[model samples]
Target chain A: MLSESETMSRFFESWRRSIFDPDIPFRRKALDVFRHQVSHVPIYARFCDTLGIDLSAESDDDNTTGSDDDNTTGSDIDNTTGSDIDPTTGSGINPPSGPKKNPAISQYSDAAIPLMPIQVFRDLLIRPDYLTIPEAVFRSSGTSGSRQSTHEIADLTLYEESCLRGFGRFYDPEQFAVRAWLPGYSDNPNSSLVAMIDTLIRHDRSGLSRFLPLDQPMHESDFDDIREQNKRIMLFGAAFGLMDLVDSGAPALPSGSVVVETGGMKTRRREIPKQELHHRLAEGFAIPRDAVHSEYGMAEMCSQAWNNGSGWFACPPWLKITIRDPQYPMELLSPGKEGLIGVADLANVHSLSFILTQDRGVMRQDGTFQVLGRWDHAELRGCNFLMES
Target chain B: MMQSDGQITRICKAVDAWLGNESGLLEQARERTISDGLFTLHDVGHMLEQVARTVTCEAITAWVEKSRDSYAVQNSGRKDSAVYDKNVLCLHAGNLPMIGLQDIIATLLSGARYHGKLSARDPWLLDGLLRLLQKQLPENVITWSTNLDDFEELRADRILFAGSEASVEPVTSRLWELRAAGKAARFLNRTARFSIAWLSGKDVEELRNKTSGAESPGLLNDLVEAVMRYEGRGCRSVAVVVAPCELSDVAGTLIPALQDYVKKYPFLHSIKPEKSYWASYLETMDRDFFESGPIILTGDTDLMGKEDVVCWISGDAMTVQQIFEKAGPKVQSIYTVENPLPLYTEALSRAQKPPIDWKPDGVDVLRWLSG
Candidate 1:
């Protein structure tokens, strides 16, 4: 049977080839994603309404004629090459009449696009709309002094597809068995990680599924069942929660377990350093130090960025990231300039492609991004203190 | 010596006669001094000088210390210490009597602090003596002008009237505009009223020890009255207490204890209804103790009850602990005896002790005014 690592590697490889097809036009892919998002999710409809952006206008410029679907207005594709028939159409193909108004687009020249603020995202989620996947909606457990915020979970099918695609891009599928600790999900049926694992098990070829140190509370378990099985296990849990299991004197995991921890540990145990946390997880899980990967995904977006056991994360081919000046969202910054990080996920065609995150990050010339930390005074200081500690 | 005593007696008698026969007039003058500081002068020379200044169209007028209330005291003799209301045209240093001339000169010099000008005789002795007498008299002895026209006609460096924000906003805006135009103006900002929380003592020894002095009972009564004045909303007012005695016993003791104060200040009763409102309010915030009314018998020796009309009772042992844990640093004062309940001790320790260095975040005008 293929081990967990093998399955992950194989899944990510397959996903990379399928999603990043060089032959597929970017506009077709964008539209396909947009349709999937609006038809399946209720949040998109309300968000478009709130922004006063007409969804009908999205397909009005295309010259290829197509029937109106439940989520679509119309499809009219433009036959003109480089220049449209009507000069008034401003869909990049036609030029303006008076002094060539609006700047010309160049292949090598990068231009800035306007992005929405975090408040708009918050307003989108707060609307009272009936959703299809009720279990996918999760409220973040707020800190002691503040109220919790609700996050909409991407549809399970979409999530599975994305995860599979993500996994297939990075690894070979035949060498590892799929086993996960799933600590956060062990107690809750509706946990996002649990749902993701369930999808993996259904599609896994290893024919072996085990959630270990089961039937016991978090403190009672010494090591995960997957660790005891002595196979290549994919460890999934929050950074702090895993550290807590380790700190409670749990024995090390069996060798070859690939640790995939998510989210920043700053909010949880503020004392632990990220490097130390990763090191401890590697030590306690009995996994290779380099196998301890960190994945960054928010409830608002579908695409996930894997740290690949490195300090930086790379976006998938279909996804594009834009670094904006933190003070001015309209200005696109240079590759190395540290500013607010915004994501353009074709995966989020169900939602808005451009999500303006509160996180601050810097993009390297290699297209990899390093998350600086959360913006704003308290969070910035808190993350800095955590790093220092 | 007999002649000297007779002369002193005659001066005293004359002063007393003047004060007793026209007490209302003296009261009016005192109010005027508090309000404007420069009003009608009894002496014609000073009055004429003021009229001349007005006639000549000088925007600013100086009244060289003409009022006797502005006198300085240098002697133990009551005759020399008497304050006169007569105004003088000018205050020249050389015109003083030789014996107490130094004091008069000092008084005249001190008048410079309040912007008084000296052109002739030293008028400080009369001015200082008058201020001292005004301080000696009760606040109620001072009378306000019934003549609205006179009050309106009199120009002021500044005038402030205290009221609630909603009630005073328009007036404040108008006054602020006037002040911008170089007219002296101010508006009193109203604040939320507060009451006291009294923790009565069950231990007779502790109660006796704390209230040992002759002034202790009056001070305690003052504390309770202070609480009721705000209906228990003011930051200074105590909202809850631990009674040393039984509920009924504490109430009985407090009623009589507060009687003298109520009589002295009739405005004390105006706060009674507010006290009742406060009691209910406290009860609503904390149901267990306040809902049961006064005299919450925790069955322990520790007596706890609300002292004023807005008293909150901590019926359970944990209530006291909770209060201690939640007590912020802004508490004004706490009354307690040695080693009372542990919770009470902790709370008292946390209560704002003197030499308070911290200020509350927002502008609390009531506290500012009271302080």
Candidate 2:
């Protein structure tokens, strides 16, 4: 008999069948995962307690706390504010006794779930209490001397599976020799991007995958070997690192090869817009402009959004993106409106699924989105500075 | 100031011309300032007027001359020009319009090269103003950029930064490392803070007694201006008003003043509904709030509230002191009408209109730049 506590079983089944099953009830699954995390993740449960979100009580699907739920039309979220914060004891509310999985309690709007700020991962150790032994800790690539965000992984296989299956949605990782040219990232063992790339490269059944040498001349012999093996170069790199490769004269690759630019260059090179950067990379790498791809991911998130040749990025079925009003963070903006980006990744279940990122983007009606740029005033938030610290 | 040198005179001329001109750069600056989203067109208008009125040549000359009397703050006529020819980088905050004006003036009058990284919010106006002065001054007088890479890479002989504590700590840590390695200079850093207004029971009683049928209370407009200015985005803008009695006791006096403020700035009445972020949060929590359209009086109790929100706390001397004690380094200034304060306290009106030599975060930037 299959135990009811087997939560990962459903997630893995969904992950395997989600590509083919277009009619999967994402809301129900998201709500289930959200309820699961609220019960098990201590840090997240504590945050929710501070927000006065009562998870023990069964809630309606669209029952938002505020009267402004009518305004939250485009996204799955409805704005939820804190309720009944204990005055004397403060927000020192403890987690529920144990993980309560009730069939009748599978209901919650997106807003009912609090979007933890990305900084929380940096300031505190966030993981499911049951799984105290983190398989790995992936950190952000911050500026020198800056505190980077640490994402403690409960399961390494979960991440590898998320990477391989997520990548497999677009292209077969085996057919393409997964070649990555990450300069700032490759050296760091804690870099999630590096880990993701490493995992993808390792899964390359052709055995022609490797990290390209940095700041050094790319040997034609290496390219010849890939060319000899009749495999396409799935070249992945940080934007600036790729540009450095372009400047150092990246050799022309075989046709059908892809150039993936992980969006960044803030500290390294003179910054350029994503479109202009893509065009330059396409020209420099001797690939068709359509072959240049952009990815939207962060150390705080489990899944990555991919852009095909255009500026717009498409999320895999497991990920949900919402555009939120920057000033009125509680209200969700309609489609075509530019606002701060909020992500709810099902794969991020081990930690917290919902995250309010520092990025600004606009989501189209088709679930595709375009990352505008970093919101500088994203630091305007100063609520409960102690809690934040 | 420095015997009214040719460059200073030319800079004064540039200021005069820039201030007098109507629809050119000022209009461009006004548009840019409004686009920052924190400010409105009317707010930009008032800010420009404030800047124009206070940043006159005489005022500049007086402040410069007074500072020079204390130290050998020579920039131009130094026989050892290299010794005094230091580059000062001013990484400014965007809370107020031309907030770094005093810093720039100090750098220029001290004869140091001014390297600036303007806050993205109020860049166009300051950039344009500096360019006007730059045309009349030496080529190396000013240089600035809004690029992230440039900011991360560029370092100077001296640094003046005003931002949040979170932003400053890392920079401070990096500077300390650099200094230990003998690669950095002495610097002054100001982090995020807010001002508060303290109202005694006597003060509230006075307002109540003075209130008649048609007229408002005494000096309340200026006090209201403290919160009304820049939508309370300035560090000196009072975010908290501590009254010795219940807010209901003086609601008549306080509400009308706020109403008058709304009359003065109709934009406050028409604030985007989406901007009621704190208000919504309070409602969802089912907590009591004293809301006035854009200005919310919530229990946030923050040292600095966001955009247009303010905190209203009722307390006696000890209670007020407790609030200030909790504030610590985060308190920028204390504003009061009658009661005497030990230090770092200003008259109610001066909270909104500080003097030319006003030391932000109690640090005399001019003294540091000159000496």
Measured by lDDT, the strongest candidate is 2
**Per-residue lDDT over B257-332 for candidate 1, one digit per residue giving the tens place of the 0 to 100 score:** 4454434434311322212322222232222222122212222111122222334353444555554444322233
What's the lDDT for residue A164 in model 2?
Answer: 76
Model 2 docking tier (incorrect/acceptable/medium/high): incorrect
Least accurate stretch of 10 residues (summed lDDT) in model 1 chain A? A380-389
**Fnat of all models, as shown:** 0.00, 0.06
| Lowest lDDT 10-residue stretch of candidate 1 chain B | B86-95
lDDT of 2: 0.66
List model 1's recovered fraction of native interface contacts, to 2 decimals. 0.00
Q: Report how far off residue B41 is in candidate 1 (Å).
A: 55
The lDDT per prediction is 0.40, 0.66
Candidate 1 vs. true structure, TM-score: 0.39
The CA lDDT at A53 in model 2 is 56
Compute the lDDT of residue B280 as modeled in candidate 1.
Answer: 28
How big an interface RMSD has model 1?
Answer: 26.5
